[model samples]
Target: MRKIYVIGIGAGDPDHLTLQAAKAIGRTDVFFLLDKGETKQSLVDLRERMIRGYSTPRRRIVEGRDPDRDRAPADYTGTIADWRTRRSQVIEDLIAEHLKDEETGSFLVWGDPSLYDSTIAILDEILGRGAITFEYEVIPGVSSVSALAAKHRIGLNRVGQPFQVTTGRRLAEGWPEGADDVVVMLDAQQAFTGHPDAEIYWGAYLGTEDELLASGRVADVADEILSTRAEARERHGWIMDTYLLRRHASD
Candidate 1:
């Protein structure tokens, strides 16, 4: 039997690596990285840095290209399912062909794997297929949401007020009912535009040297965020951003 560790590497900062994640790095004989492409090479670079700084000297890093998906596919769920299936096969091959029995493998996820990440789901699919067998555990790390809150010096939720965490797609439908605040993630479309009256705390490339943050009434800052996101994406070839929208009490 083989064992694997899915360890969250934190939002972006190497310092955000927890003791447990550091320990997991030491336990890994091989680390698997799913490369997202040249635009996000910084992410792959960061993973390499973590592996070098924390893992054992003799550790190995296995790189694989991530399957691409349509950004605006009509069949969103079906596309995602197919993408995951492809990714699972890649991972299964990495584990079966690369790792030896009783050896351990690890994946350094960006943010807590329990959040919006799909590594766990893909691995589960691989396990279900029975092509490979291994025991695994998750080590949570600081998420971009947490990094946003920390950088902005704001709590995710107000006292006694519930907040919803959702994607930019759902946010386009409308603000969620029953929640005074919402944390929007993976929103490339600047959905915050719809709620101009809401207050927003937005951050991009959080916890890294390139981090950009803005806050104020959505009407005031939405344009700035939009322009900034565009500039950042053009500059870095990729961008990861999250924001909090808080509707005023009177609204």
Candidate 2:
């Protein structure tokens, strides 16, 4: 039987790749790269660059086409279900074609494979079908959450306080009931607006030389962040950012 390794490549920086992750890449027979279309071409390029820098010639690169982002349904639940289904098919096909004779193939994931990433989730479903008999291994990498905390020079969780990690959509729906510290990712609508009393430390393009950092009370910094994010996106054509929010006791 063959084994499939899902390895997290960390954020953008080559130095962020953990030793285990690098070793996994070096050992794999084939590598799968996700191409999230042209809008995110840099993401694909960055992964390629990392693989080139770290992996030996024994590993072959295979590119996977991204599902059509426009095809996503407006309904959140249905959209995710549909996307996952399509993604699983893509992976199944890729595996059959590329790894037919290989004992181990790997997929390089951005950030941590376990956090907010759907790669492992989709793969789990495919494996559950029992159509393919394969062992799975997850090589963890430094998540954007840790990168953000390090960039800001602050701990993610307050002393003796609980912290939560959530998406911008959830934050927009409403601040989670009892979180003292919240790390928000995949923010599209600037969900910080929902929390009036939180303090925020936001970073964009983390680990890259062009990173932008800002900190202030949420209410005061929210608009600035929104505007800056817009301008930054316009200038760079894309942005990957994360932020930490805390409801200060004094507020």
Candidate 3:
């Protein structure tokens, strides 16, 4: 039987790849890549750099065109479900044809695999279809949330207080109940702007040279974050940002 590695390669930093992740890379026989087009060339470059640095010399690389989906779909959940199924099929074909018995293949994920990433779920879906057979493992890496907290020199939660990690969609709906500190990810809508009184620590393009960071009460810095985010998105053609929102910073 073949094996698969869902290795967390960290958030755009070579150093962020843990030693264990390096070992996993060395053991991989094939690397499955999804080409998201030229707009995401930087991500492709990062993965290429890592494969060259840590992978075995004889390792093979394969690319598949990533399926496109509506970025602003009205039926968000249903759209994502369809997209994931399509993506799973792409990966399943790669594994079946390229990965041979007793060999290893890998998917280098950004941030920790257990975070908001879908690689694990996609693999599970592929297996559930019973078309492929491969034992798999996950190697954790530094998550952007942890990097954001570290960059801002603050802990995620106040002592003994609880915090929740949620998406911009949920945050836009309303601040979660029973959690004072909310870490928001995938906020294409700038939901953080709604909580004007909250203290916010924000970071964009984390773990890379073009990284940006800002912190202040939302009332004081919302415009700054909005402009900065817009400019960066325009410049890079993409952006991945996360923030920690505190209901009471003085506490």
Question: Whole-model Cα lDDT per candidate?
Answer: 0.91, 0.83, 0.94
| lDDT over C-alpha atoms for residue 15 of model 3 | 96
Error of 1 at 18 (Å): 0.3
For candidate 1, lDDT tens digit of each residue in 173-231? Answer: 98899998999998977888999999999998899999999999999988888988999
Q: Which regions of candidate 3 are displaced past 4 Å?
A: 249-251
In model 2, the worst 10-residue window by lDDT is 65-74
Q: Higher-lDDT candidate among 1 and 3?
A: 3
Against the true structure, what is every candidate's RMSD?
0.8, 1.8, 1.3
TM-score of each: 0.98, 0.93, 0.98
* Displacement of the residue 113 alpha carbon in candidate 3, Å: 0.9
Q: How far off is residue 161 in model 3, in Å?
A: 0.8
lDDT of 3 by residue, 101-171 (tens): 99999999999999998899999999899977899999999999989998999999889999999999999
The predicted structure with the larger lDDT, 2 or 3, is 3
lDDT tens digits, residues 90-122, model 2? 988888788855468898888899998888888
Off by over 4 Å in 1: none
